[model samples]
Target: MKVQYFAETDTLYIEFQDLKIVETKDLDENTALDLDANGRVCAITVEHASERTDVHRLTVEGIAA
Candidate 1:
C-alpha cells in the first residue's frame, strides 16, 4: 500500500494495489474510489483533503505475499 498527498490540490490518494485504475467512482464530491478493469478496488481519491480528511500521520502494518 502507498499513500500520497498533493499539497497543491490538498487531495489524498491511497493505493491498495499496484494495478492501474481504469475507472473512478465518486462517493461524494470530496471522496472517490478507484477500480481496476476487473472491478476490484485499486485505489482511493479524496478531494479537499485538508478540510475533508486528516492529512498528517499515516501508519501501515502488514505483510504481502
Candidate 2:
C-alpha cells in the first residue's frame, strides 16, 4: 500500500495494490476510485486535496496485514 500527494496537481492518491486499473469510477466530483479487472479496488484518487483533506499531515494506524 502507498499514499502519495502531488503538490502540483493538489491531488492525493492512495494505492491499495500494484495492479492494472481496468476502470475508473467517480465517487464524487472531487474523488475517484480505481478498480482492477477483477473488480477489486486498486486505488483512490482525490482532487483538490488541500481543500478536501489535510494532505500536509498524515497518520497511519493499525496495519491491515
RMSD for each of the candidates: 1.7, 1.3
Name the best candidate (by TM-score): 2
lDDT string, candidate 2, 11-43, tens digits? 999999999999999999999999999999999
lDDT of each: 0.88, 0.97
Worst 10 residues of 1 by lDDT: 56-65
Model 1 / residue 14 / CA error / Å: 0.4
- Mind giving the per-residue lDDT tens digits that candidate 1 earns over 1-65? 88999999898999989997899998988899999999999989998888877688776667667
TM-score of each: 0.82, 0.91
Best by lDDT: 2
Off by over 4 Å in 2: none
Inter-residue clash pairs, candidate 2: none
Candidate 1's C-alpha runs over 4 A off are 63-65
lDDT of 2: 0.97
